[model samples]
Target: MGDERGMTRMLLECSLSDKLCVVREQQYEVIIVPTLLVGIFLILLGVILWLFIRGQRGQDRRPAVRGTAPTPPSRALSGEGAGHGENVCVPLKETSVESFLRATTPDLAKLQVPREQISEDLEKIHNGSCGAIYRAKLNTGDPAKSKSVVLKTLKEPAGLQEVQDFLGRIQFYQHLGKHRNLVQLEGCCTERLPLYMVLEDVAQGDLLSFLWTCRRDVMTMDGLLYDLTEKQVYHIGKQVLLALEFLQEKHLFHGDVAARNIVIQSDLTAKLCGLGLAYEIHARGAISPTRAVPLKWLAPERLLLRPAGIKGDVYGAPPYPEVPPTSILQHLQRGKTMKRPSSCTQTMYSIMKSCWRWNEDNRPSPRELYLRLEAAAKTADDKAVLQVPELVVPELYAAVAGITVESLSYNYSVL
Candidate 1:
């Protein structure tokens, strides 16, 4: 009986030991799982905080780049009725590029100008908008018919630099005053809604029309001073050169000198009209491609994606092709290409060639062109005289009905 009792006691001890081992294992598993879960949660929270901080810092840097459209005060009060008083001035819709060009008075005009200066003449021109231009009469010492003037009002939207440019032009005119080649600003009034500038009215209009007329029809001698003669062309070329020289002497660049910006008076005197596109020599180096000016009449360095320097004017030139006699004959033939003329109008062709050289550096400076033209004007022996042969530029001839090289005869009487 004693032996059996001892065995039962041993068995009981074994069962208790097993239970203790199983309990220890379960406790260890529970503790490890909780620690791992806590570690994962801490990592996720840290990542979220880092992303939030970085996003906020980015937002603070460039507010404009964040896709937020700035609301102008003008747009906010649009369509709010006639009951609004004069004191409650609201902003207008964002000024467009076209309206800026055509409008006689722009919205910015109000910001800079005072109320008293506003006049009926200040109404917008219904044209493209780059700036506001006002037409006013100037005291030319004759009260009977006061000389008409054009005033360009410049007000920048958000760009302070552009405003500075407008101011600089004002100073430029204020100091230099008027020149025949320049559009004369008789006076300026920046007091209120419509800034005032008094400038000569170019009744003859812009340069583009002049070029087109010359290209299409035979210019009337009553209005034109020069014919298609090389000497005449050379003289005209010289006049342009002199204008360019005057600008260069002042250390200014007419950055945009295309056919469109030039204006011809009744006397056939050409004036460079648009000063808004003009830039000082100092700013040329840093001028962005966005502001690099247009492609027409541009130096190749300015055209071919090359870096433009002060020496840029000396490089990249456009190649000018003269009216080919074959082109003339083709016109005569109702638009069929003809044989290239041997050498009749070579001088005239040469002028075009020089004007259109590929390298600006190789191109003649205005001074050089002026000198050449002046020389050609005086001397019969001038090798530069282009003889418009019976077969002139055929391409030009082919384009026009009833026009041919044979149809054109140089009559000194016309001159």
Candidate 2:
């Protein structure tokens, strides 16, 4: 009876110990599960708060413009003052040709021409310092629609400088865009060797050649047979003035503006060519040392190695008017006093004289020149001007260079 009581007491004691261990495990689970869940919730809340704050910061960074779309971050801010100030926010020294092209011509892919489409055996029309210009036929999808184009290639053994110049010219055209008075860039082939820049073929060639031809004979166009009239001179002058006005608005100037640099179409339209000088001005914010600026065409300030500005372009107009060729030589020899052309009307003479003014401040702006030319064109009579014989004595041109007119054709290639 005593042994049975002892065994029953031991069993009850063991059962009580088991119940205590189970209660302890349950209590530990309840506390640990709630602590873990709270930690997870706090982590999630922190992530959400961080994301919301980041979004608010981004929104605050971009201020909206009134009555306009938000300004792009890349656009350059205008300069505060004029007179060779940093007019554009672009870094002049660091602006690579590739970056400039990408920024200005984002859709340049469409302007790329296939190498196979251009003819290999095209005739060279002109040879320039950069390279030779060839007349090529671009094969379009339709045989009849295939058109003639001018291909300007980099010279043989082209080095780093040549490549940079080629790319710079391409960048300039991209910035210039399309205009009626400017030579249109059709396409470019830069992927392959001997990179080519395709341009529209101006059929009648450059104005210098056209003027030479006209001086030799009374050229006929559109059923009108006549010499170059003062009215026609005004017409050409007006077109050039229009181009200059366009360039001025873009903060550019045609550094070399003369008949040789102007391309004449058979339709009597004059388009400006010779962008090499213009490119130099664009890149360096002044003339490049490599450029050989014709002294006769340059203003007195430019000839004296002074800084060139918009006023320098005004000096380019005197050579185009019907002045005696020797007059330029005489004017340069005499020092500062240039005689007005006797053939030109008093109004036209006054304009040319004003362009040659010793004081640049007195010179008219391109816009003013355009207006004056427009007025001259409206009031002038073509019939009386046509009666005067076209006078371009080859001997006079030959005297300066010690070459014949025929030889000048090969020697002189505009800019």
Please list the C-alpha lDDT of all candidates, in the order they appear: 0.47, 0.67
At residue 67, give the lDDT of candidate 2.
13
Please give, for residues 69-159, the per-residue lDDT of candidate 2 as tens digits. 1111111011112112222222222235335445534456777888778765577666656666778889897879988998877643333
RMSD of each: 13.7, 19.2
Residue 194 of candidate 2: its Cα lDDT? 52
Q: After aligning candidate 2 to the native by TM-score, how far in Å is the CA of 281 from where it should be?
A: 2.0
TM-score of each: 0.51, 0.66
| Pairs clashing within candidate 2 | none
Cα error, residue 101 of model 1, in Å, equals 23
